[model samples]
Target: MPKPLYQCRVLVTATSYGVHDPALKTTLESQVGEVVYNQSGRPFTAEELAALIPGFDACIAGLDRFDRQVIARADHLRVIARYGTGVDNIDLDAAREKGIIITNTPAANADSVAELTVGLILALARNIVVADRETRAGLWPRLQGISVNGKTVGLIGFGAIGRRVAQKLSGLGCQILAFDPYTDPASGEGLAHFTSREEVIASADFLSLHCPLTGQTRGMVDAAFLKSMKRGAFLINTARGELIDEAALIAALNEGHLRGAALDVFTRQPPGADHPLLAMPQVIVTPHMGAHSDHAANAMGWGALNNCLAVLRGEEPENRVV
Candidate 1:
C-alpha cells in the first residue's frame, strides 16, 4: 500500500512558491506530515540540497542546482516538481536513472512573461527609464522615441510565451517576423510572418528573444551576431541570459552597433553593481522578475503543489519530464 499522506515529508525550495497565495501552503501542510521551507530566501546550492534531500518525499524546486550528486543523495525523494516552466537546472539523466519523477508547470507564467517582454521593448525604444530619471532630477528635456506602429519586430522563438507576445503586439500595426524551427509555420499565419533566421536578423527594427536556452542557443548572440543587426535597432531579451555573450553585447553597445538593450535575465543572477552591463546608460535591467506577477505566481504555486501531491499519491503527474 502507498504511504499515508500524513507520513510524507515535503521540501519546498522555491522562494515565491506560496507568497502570492498562502492557501497553497495550508493545503500542502494539511496533507503532509512535515513541510520544510527554504529559509534562505534564495535557491539552495547542490551541496545544501544533497544534505537536505535524504528525508524528503518530494521537493517543489526553483532555479537550484540538481546535479547527479544531489540526485544520488535523494534517498526518499520520489519527485522534483519545478515551480516554474524551466528545468534547465536539473540533471534529467540522473533523475531518470534514480526513478525520481520530474515535472514542471509549463506555460503557467507565459502571459506575465509576455507582458513584461512587450513592456521592456517599449521602455527601450522610448528611453523611458532615462527620461523618468532625468525628470525626477529636475531636468525638462524632451526625449525622442520611436513608435512600434510601423516597425518590424522579430522573435527568435515561437513557443507559448512567444505566441502570446506576438498576439499582444498584433493590434499595434507593426510587422511581426518570427523564426522557430520547432513550431509549425501555419500557426503564425495571421499573427506573424514565419521567416528565415537570417532574414529576421537583417530586417527587424526591434529584435526580441523568446527562445529557450540550449547548447545550440547559448551565446548565440555573440559579437558577429550583434554586428549583423540593423544599425540602431533595439534588442530585448526576456529569455535566458547565457543566450547572449555579455562581453560581446558590451562591445556592441560601446561601438554603437546597436541602439540599446533591455534585459530581464542576466548571465548571473543579481549581477554585481560594478558589472559593466549595469554601468551602461543604454542598457535597462530588471531583477529576473518576468514571472513574478500575482496571477502567474499563484498559478505556478498551485500547479507545482498539485504535481507534487499527485506523484506522492501514486498517480501520474501532469507535465512529467522524466
Candidate 2:
C-alpha cells in the first residue's frame, strides 16, 4: 500500500525558505500533511539531524551537515530538496546507498551570485569598505583606486554563475579569461575566452573563483598556487570556501604578495570575531550572502518546494542530482 500524500511529513531546514514569498509555504503546507521548520536559525549538525530525521518523508534542506551517519538514521526520508545549487555539503554517496533522492535548484541563484561577485570586484578595486569606514569616522581621506576597464579578469570556473558573471562584465571592457575543463567552448560563446588554468592564474589582474567544491579542488589554492599569481593582483571567491587554504591567503596578504581578497564564503561559517581574516582591512568578507537577493530567495524556495512535493507524490523532480 502506498503512503497517502496528505499523510506525508516534510522537514525544512533552510533559514530563508519562503521568507520572500509566503505562497511557497502555503503551497507546501497544502500538499503535505505536516511541515516542520528548523528553529535553530542555522544549519543543523549531523547529530542534530540524526535526532530529527527518522520520521520525515522528505526534507527541504539548507547547508546542513548531511553526513553518512545522518543519512543512515533517516529511516523514512525519501528525498532531499536543496534550497540552493551547491550539494557539496550533502553526502552524495550515503544518499545514493540509502536510495534517497537529492535535487538542487540550478541557475536559480546564478544572477544573484554573479551580481555580488561583480560588486565585490568593484569594492576591492576601489577600496570602498575602507573609504566608507573612514568617512563615517569623520575623516575624509582621498584614496587611489584602480579602474576595471581593460583589466584582465580571470575566472577559475565557467559554469552557469561564471558565464553570467562574464556576460555582466562584458560591457565593462574586461578581458575575461576562464578555465573549466568540463565546460564546452561553444557554451561560453563571446562571453569569455576559455583558456588553460595556469595561464588564467598568472595573467589575471583580478582572479575570481566560481568552481564547485570537490575532493579534487579542496585546498587547491595553497601557498604554491598563491605564489604563482601575478604580484599585487586581487583574489575573489564567491564559490566554496574550502577551495582556498585560508592560512596561505593570510600569509600572501600579509607579505603583500596579493593586494587583497573578497570572500563570500569561508572554510567555517561565521569565522568568529577574532578570526585572522576579519582583522585585515584589505580583505572584504560577507556572511555567505551572495545568494540572498529577494528574487533568488523566491526562486530557490519555489524550486525546492516543488522538488519536495514532486518526489513525495511519486513523480520525477526537475532537478534530480542523485
Candidate 3:
C-alpha cells in the first residue's frame, strides 16, 4: 500500500495574527497536522526564538532572529520559509548544516517598494509634507521645491527593484547614473555607471539607495561621504537603514549641505519618539513600510506559503536562501 502523506507540525513566527488574509494556517492545515502560530512582530532574541522553535517540522518566519542556537533547538525543523526577500535575519550556515531548506519570497513586493521609493524621492525634492502642513494651517507658504526634470539621479544598486526605479525615473526625463559593482553590461538599460561612489554622489542631483546592507555597505554613507555630495543635493533610502550613518545625515541636513532626505527604514525600528531625525523638517521618515502595502503583504504571504509547500514536497522552490 502507498504510504500516507507526511503529517507535519508547523510554527509561524513574527507574523500578525490576522495579517494573512486567507491565513497560512488554513492553507497549511490541508497538508500538515497541528500548526502553531505566534505574532511576535519584531525580530525575537536568539534565546526567545530557540525556546519557541522546538518540535516544529516547518516554520514560516518573519524578521525574527534565527541563529545557529535557535536552529539547533528546532530538532524537527525541516524547512524555514521567510516572508520577505531579505534573509539576513536567518543563519544560513546553520540551516544548511541541519539540512533544513531556507526560502524567501523575492519580487513579491518589488513594485510596491519601487513605487514607494519614487514617492519618497518626490516628497524629499518637493517639500510636500511641509507645504501641506502650512497650507492646512491657513497659510499660503510659497516654499520653492526642486524640479526632478533635467536632474541627475544616482542609483546605488541595480537589482530588481533598483532597475525598476531607474526605469520609472527615466520616464521623468532625469538622467540616470548608477554605481553597482555587480552590474551586468548585458542588462542593456543604457544607464551610465560610475567607477566610484564618490563620483556618483558628487555628480548626481539626487541620490537613491537600493543596495542590501552588508559588512561593506553598513555605515558606508557617513559624514565624509555626505560632505562629498553636491551642495543642496537630496538623499533617499528605501533599502536598509544601517546603510546610512544617521548622525552624519542629521549633521549634513542641519548644516544645509543637503537640501533634504527621505528614509523608509531605520537602524532602529520605531526609533524613539524623540529621534533627532523626526525633529528635522528637512528629513522625512517612514516606519519601515516600504514593503507593507496590502497588495505586497498578500503577495508575500502567498509566495512564502507556496515555497514552503514546494520544499515539503521535495521540489526546488524559487527564492531558496539556503
Candidate 4:
C-alpha cells in the first residue's frame, strides 16, 4: 500500500473571524495532514506560538507577534502567509535566518484604506459625529465645519494608498502637498513636494499621515511638531497609531490649537473604554477598520493563501516579503 500521499501539518494564526471563512478552512484541510487555528485577535505569546509551531509546514498569520524565538522553534515551518499588508508586527530578519519565506498581500486593500482616510478627513473636518449627537439630543446648536475645497492638504507618505488619496483630494479641488523621501520630485503631475515636515505642517490646512511605522517615524508627531502646524488646521492619521504622540495630540486638541483630529489606529488596540481621546469632542476615532472591507479582506486571504501554496509547490510567489 502506498503511504498516505503527503503528511503535512499547517497552522493558522489569523484573527477569529477569518478562521470561520469556508474558503480558508477548506483550503487548509485539503492540503495539510493537521491544522490548528487561533481565533483570538490578540498576539500570541512566544512560548505559546513556539510550542504549537514545531510541526507545522506552513502558517497563515495575522498581526500576531512572531519573533525570532518563535521562528527558531518552528523547525518544520516553511512559509508565513500574512493576512494583511503591513509586516511590521513580524520580525523579518528572523524569518530570513530560518530560511522561511514571508509573504504579504500588498495593494490588496489600497482602495479600502484610501477610502477610509478620505472619510476620516471629512468626518473630523465637519464634526460629523459630534453634530449628530447634539442633534439627537434635541439641541439645534449649529456648528460650522470646514470645507475640503481650497484647503492645502499635506500628505506625509506617497505610497500606493497615499497616491490614491492625493488623486481623490485633488479631484475635490484641494491643493496637494506631499513629502516622501522615496518619491521622485518630478513624478506626480500636480502634487508638490516640500523639503521639510515643518514646512508642510506650517503651510497646510489639513495634514494626513500615510507613512509606514519605522524607527525614524515612531512618535514623530509630538508637541513640537504639532506646534508648527497652521492654527485651526485638522490632522488625520490612517497609518500606524504609534506614528503620532497621543499625549501631545490630546494636549493640542484640549488647548484649542488644532481644530480637530481623526484617528483610525491607536497606540493601544481597543484603547481602554475610558481612554482620554474618547472623551474629547474635538477628536474622532475608529476601531482600526481601514482594511476591513469585504473586498480587501477577500483579496488578502486569497492572495496570501495562494502564495503559501506556491511556496509549498517550490515556486517563488510574487508577493514574497522575505
Candidate 5:
C-alpha cells in the first residue's frame, strides 16, 4: 500500500517478530527493499554487531549494544528501532553524534511488564515457588507467607509500568506508595500516593523497582538501602538487573532483614548453576520474561519495524528516544 513508503537495506537483528509472522517480514521487505536477518536467536555482542551492521541502512534492534565503537563502524546505519522499551543498551550520545535515529517501542509491553511485576510480588509474598517445588517432590510442606492485602507496597518509579502496577495492585487492597521526583504526582492519583523515598524504604511491606537503568539508578539498592527497608520486607524486581546489588540482597535475605525476593531480572542472566541465589530457598527467579507475552511480542515487533520504516521515510518515529 502507498508504494511501500521507503527503500533501503536493513538488518532484522531481533529474530522473533518477523520470523513468527512472514507477512510482517514481507511488509518490512517492501519498505526496506532488502532485509538481512539474524537467525542465531540471541543478542549479539558489540564485536558481533560491528561486523554485522556496517552495510545495513537500519536495524530492528533487540538488546544488542550499539555503543560508540559499534556505531562508529556502522558506515550506513541510518536508524535503529529498539524491540523493547529500554534503550539502556544503546549509547544515545554515540547514536546522536553518528546521526543515527534511535527509536524504542515505548509502552508497547507496559501492561505485560506490569502484570509480571505483580505476579512476582505475589510469588514472593505467597512462597509460590517453594510450595510448588515441595509439592512436586512429594512433600506436603506448608510455609507461612505474607499477604498483599492491607500491605504498604512501595514503587520506586512512577513511569508507565509503575503506574500500571499501582492500578492493578489497587484492586488487591494494597496501599501503594510511589517515590519518583521527576514523575507527575497526578500519575499516582487514586491508585497510589506520592511519597518520599526514605519513607517508602522505611515503611513499605513490599518494595518493587520500576525505574530505568541509568548512571544514578544503577546499584541504587545497596547495603544501606536494604538495611533501611522495613524488617521482614519483601523485594520484587522486574526491572533491570543492574538496579539492585545482588550480594546485598542475598545478605539481607540471609540475615532475615528481608523475608524473601522474587526476581524476573538478575545481575547476571541465567546465572551460573552454582550461583548462591539459585540455591537460596528464600529467592524465586524467572528468566526475564516480563515483556515476553505473545501479544506483547507482536506489538513490539510491529512497533520496532515501523519505527525503522518511519525514519527511512524521513518522518518522526513513533517512539524516538534519541
Candidate 6:
C-alpha cells in the first residue's frame, strides 16, 4: 500500500497491541505517517496526554481521560480512534466541538466479552472458583451449586455482547429476559423476552449487566436496585464498573440479600490487594479480562488503526462516533 498524500503523526496510547501481537503494531506503523507508542505502561494522565498529544495529528485512545482541558491542548489532533467500544472516558462533546473525528471498534471484542460474561455466570452459579481454591488446599469438601438450567437470566443490555450472552445461555436451557428500551422485543430470536428493567431485576435468578456507562446508568445499581432483586440472586457485571455502587454491593452480600457476585470490571482499574471484595469467599473476580482474548485484541487494534488512518487520508471511516 502506498502512503497517503498527507502523512499525519499518530500517537498510540493503547499499549497492549504490541504485546498482544506485534503484527498488529506493524500493520499500524505501515499505514500511518508517524507513530508514537505510549512509553508508560498504563494510561496517560490528563496533564501528560495534553502535553504529549499537541503534536500528533491522530490518537489511538485507551482508557485515558480526554477532558475539556486535555482536548483544548490538542491543537493539531484531527481524529481519535478508540481501541475499544466504550468512549465514555473520552470527552466526546469536546472532540465534537473541536471538529475532531472520533471512532471506536464496536463489537470488535464482542465474542470475547460475551464469552467471559457467560463464564462469570457459570462460575458464580457453580461455585467453581471457591471449589477450586478449597480443593487446592487439600480440603475436598463438596459444596452445593445452583444449576442454570430452567432458571431465568436477566440481561440489562441487549447490544452485541448481550445478544451473544443470551444466545449462548439458550443452549443450556436457560430462560433469558432482556431490558433495553432501544432494542426491539422480536429481535431476540425467541431466546429472550424484552421486559421492564424492574421486572428483570425482581424476576430473574441471575442478573448480568452489559450496559454502557452513561449519565443515565452511572451508579444506577445502588441500594434501591439491590433491594429489588430476588433474595439470594446472583449478580454479574462484565460492563462498566461505575454502573454498580461497590458499597451497595458489599452491603447486599453481607446482609444475605444476595448470594454471590462476579465482577470483571471495577470502578478502580486495579483494586488494592487487600480490597474487601478480594477477601470475600463467595465473590469471584477477574482483572477485566472480558476482552483480552487474542482474537479480540487483534481485531480491536487493527480496526482502531485503520479508522484513524482513514481520517488522516481524508476518507470517511466506518466507525465514526463524532
What do the candidate models score in CA lDDT, each in turn? 0.93, 0.94, 0.82, 0.82, 0.87, 0.89
Worst-scoring 10-residue span by lDDT in model 2: 1-10
- lDDT (C-alpha) at residue 61 in model 4: 82
Q: For every model shown, what is its TM-score relative to the native structure?
A: 0.97, 0.98, 0.91, 0.90, 0.95, 0.95
Residue pair clashes in candidate 5: none
Shift of residue 185 alpha carbon in model 1, Å: 1.2
lDDT of 3 by residue, 1-322 (tens): 2112257777777465237576655777778767777755666777998998887777888778898999999887778998878887788888999999999888877888889999988887788999998899999998888889989988888787888887777778888788788877456256555547678889888899988878899999999999999999999999988999999999999999998898888888778898999998888888887888778888888888888787777788887888
Weakest lDDT window of 10 consecutive positions for candidate 6: 1-10
Candidate 1 regions with alpha-carbon error over 4 angstroms: none
Clashing pairs in 6: none
Stretches > 4 Å off in candidate 2: none
Model 5, range 180-260, lDDT digits (tens) per residue? 989999877788889899999898999999999999999999999999999999898999999999999889999999988
In candidate 2, how many clashes are counted? 0
Q: Highest TM-score, which number? A: 2
> Cα deviation in Å at residue 251, candidate 5?
1.2
Q: For residues 183-258, could you state the per-residue lDDT of candidate 1 as single tens digits?
A: 9999998989999998898888999998888889999999889988999988899889999999999998999989
How many clashing pairs per prediction, in order? 0, 0, 0, 0, 0, 0
lDDT by residue for model 2 over 72-167, one digit each (tens)? 999999999999999998999999999999999999999999999999999999999999999999999999999999899999999989999999
Per-residue lDDT of 196 in model 2 = 92
Clash pairs of candidate 4? none
Reference-based lDDT, residue 300, model 5: 92
lDDT of each residue in 18-42, candidate 6, tens digit only: 6778987877777766789998888
TM-score of 1: 0.97
Root mean square deviation (Cα) for candidate 6: 2.2
Candidate 3, position 47, lDDT: 92
Q: What overall lDDT, based on C-alpha atoms, would model 5 receive against the true structure?
A: 0.87
Model 5: lDDT of residue 101: 90
- Backbone clash pairs for candidate 2 read none
Looking at model 1, residue 317 earns an lDDT score of: 96
Decide which is better by lDDT, 3 or 6. 6
Better of 2 and 6 by TM-score: 2
